[model samples]
Target: MADLKGKSRATTTPADGCALCSLPLLVPQEPSSDIEDDEDEETPSHLIDDVELPCGDHFHWDCLMNASKISPVDKLRFCLFCRQQAVTIADDGSEKLLVHVRNEGGLTSNFDLGEEIRSEIAFDSNPHLRRTEAFLSLMSQDDLETAEEMLRGEDGAEPVDPNSTYEEGGLTALHVAAYNNNVRAIELLLRYGAQKDKRSNDGASPLDCASQVEAWNAVQVLNS
Candidate 1:
């Protein structure tokens, strides 16, 4: 990430401001004198190419790319605010935030993040999605006891149906659990009436979802 040591010169900032430097979305007024230019140095306009992630937050391209580099894993990088896969539109309307990966052979290639980690990127407006997300979170954390209680409508709260679909994708609790490789959570949901063969709106079964993310443990459990 470019060292944002100087204050932003712009008077107005985007409401969805850049998360990394916390400065105005505009390019830095001038490149830091300390930064030596190289053959690959990007122009100011290119450097300031801001992007809005799937989570609805904006960030500078360089800053987001720098943050993504921290993850050594080969999987798609997610937004810091929400753990959903990070995707955005380029100025030309093409998919931005392509993940460039290097293999053991030292070859590099870019790939678009077409994978969907969470159907609901931001659930602030939808109470149903928020509640369902909470249940999914508990499942990911392996808090089976609380998850069961929520399913049973304990404490006067409306019971969360284990098989109920959520958000635009119509993903069931089992789909989420399987995608996250939470074997224990899968077993818990199955015990509480979650359908093992339930499919998402995209027609992906729990096993298919698990395999998409290479969640081997979840795949084994679902296959059995």
Candidate 2:
């Protein structure tokens, strides 16, 4: 089993295919540069070695960084593959997180713009409500990593109640997942103690939310 708090203890080998991009992990080579004295030239992505996520999945370094660019550093501190919380252990026995700056071509670029309008809005007065917003946002984007962290409270943060309702939509995480047609998220929420029959402020169950949105996959998961 992999450790959720820090780097995974699971032994890993350089696999043939990268878990993130599904591309071959070729042997690393020295980056060629015609301008030898140029200080501004960045190292090429292909020159980096394979990187192992805390979940025990191997990915090309560029693929991992590319994936990192999609997630907000403040919200997603876990592995995108297995939703395992990852941390770097300092010499002083404290854990620190190193976040990569966001760039284009990640989840933000592929996500539907209209979906943001429908996402759960956070109330500015309460910081706790941001957790709810984060959960809903993760569900909307199918971001299992941060969602699992919130659900499990693995990092010592307060666990996100699966039945907790957002002030704006008055919807639970399940409802949000259903509305997004996120079957995997629906399953994860259900496994983490979400009640499928729990009603929103408008008397909408998760199934009802899926039905309203024609989220067939979510409906099937909820029904099952």
TM-score for predicted model 2 compared with the true structure: 0.43
Superposed model 1: Cα runs more than 4 Å off: 1-133, 140-142
As a TM-score, model 1 comes out at 0.41
Residue-level lDDT of model 1, residues 79-135, one tens digit each, is 765667765567887554554322112212233433222222234235666677778
Alpha carbon lDDT of residue 28, candidate 2? 49
For this target, which candidate reaches the highest TM-score against the unseen true structure?
2
Off by over 4 Å in 2: 1-127
What TM-score would every model get versus the actual structure?
A: 0.41, 0.43
For model 2, the local distance difference test gives 0.62
lDDT of 2 by residue, 32-74 (tens): 6675745687554442235554445555556654554455543
Q: List clash counts for every candidate, in order.
A: 0, 0
What's model 2's lDDT at 109?
13
